[model samples]
Target chain A: MLNISNIVLEIFNILMKRIVLMGVIILMVVATVYLWLSNSGFSEGEGPYLGIIALILVFAVFLLIRRIKSWKVGEPQEDELSKKVMVRTAALSYYVSLYLWVFLLYMQDRVTFDKDRLIGIGILGMAIIFALSWVFHHFRGVPND
Target chain B: MTNRIKEFRVKLGLTQEELAKKVNVRRETIVFLEKNKYNPSLRLAFDLAQILNVSVEDLFSFEDEK
Candidate 1:
């Protein structure tokens, strides 16, 4: 199910979907780790998240052995500049996420969305914003001024 | 802020990749630094200056925005 092939176009579609699913899972792991680490201390609610991240990392490593080719095992990926970029991106995303929350709060009375779904949307929006902001800063660099 | 990192690096016959490797940063960081778009940390500036064999003052200068 995970194998990608050049010869068979039909099976390739299925494999591509699987690959994308794996990628999303990895991204979720990154988001979870970022949020967990950014917090001052671990809460009881975070215990399950830690377990989830561990399981995801193990699965990701298994995938890495067979599928991913770019990343090396045990090699450090982040550098000093990348760290700076992440810090800046995280700070920027926090401010933007507040507006999203305010909008959600504003919509609570008008919109029929369930409380759980609304909270889920807010979390997803934060992740997407963080990812996009990180990409922007990674390529463009944080503004000197 | 403006930096002469590219000038000094070229004089030392080092590519951006090589300099980044020496300084333990990504090559993109060097590209941004050379373009004067990123203000590097003091430690990074010191490390880069040392690698390029230039003083930090010679490598980077700040222009006050009036």
Candidate 2:
């Protein structure tokens, strides 16, 4: 019962899925590198790693912007439930980040905080948000049976 | 909330996908709404009413007994 158009659609869907997965992998690798660079001590004239990390962060931001810009919003687009789930997931992630930041502040004895650590936490928060949103979107209405 | 979306959609000879397109939502959203498993936002409800040519009250209902 598979028509040519159906086959093509399926292939496109698979390709899109693969691209998303790859994007996630790249993001994770960049995040790991960033964390490692931030935590490890560096010698004089060895600041290029930070520059490389900044470039990777910029690339990640660009990809996210591109994805959002290409997202369709109007008629024949994703339905109300999907939109609701998306909004809810984002809100949840924001609250989670807020609570975690508060906890970190409470645990620290010093009034001042490390800028690099703060930035690292921010990146991790965003990663968690995206991962959770994607998971919720994928599994929202599926039956357990 | 309960609705007669499926009946209206059928009467108008519109498929779920067609209605979703008209309402500016995803097809699965239409499915969920029809099944009464999901509630929509006020804006979305208004949009759906406009597309269905019905009032929000006509499209949706609230029951205290439920």
Cα lDDT computed for each candidate against the true fold: 0.75, 0.67
Can you tell me which runs of candidate 1 are displaced by over 4 Å? A1-76
- Model 2: which residue pairs collide? A75-B24, A78-B26, A79-B26
Question: Per-residue lDDT tens digits of candidate 1, residues A57-107?
Answer: 664656544343312221224556677888988999999999999999999
Report DockQ per prediction, comma-separated. 0.29, 0.24
Relative to the unseen true structure, what is the C-alpha lDDT of residue A141 in candidate 2, on a scale of 0 to 100?
Answer: 51
Give the Å error, residue B3, model 1.
1.2
Best by TM-score: 1
| DockQ measured for candidate 2 | 0.24
- Error in Å for residue A39 of model 1: 32
Residue A63's lDDT in candidate 2:
50
Candidate 1 backbone overlaps, count: 0
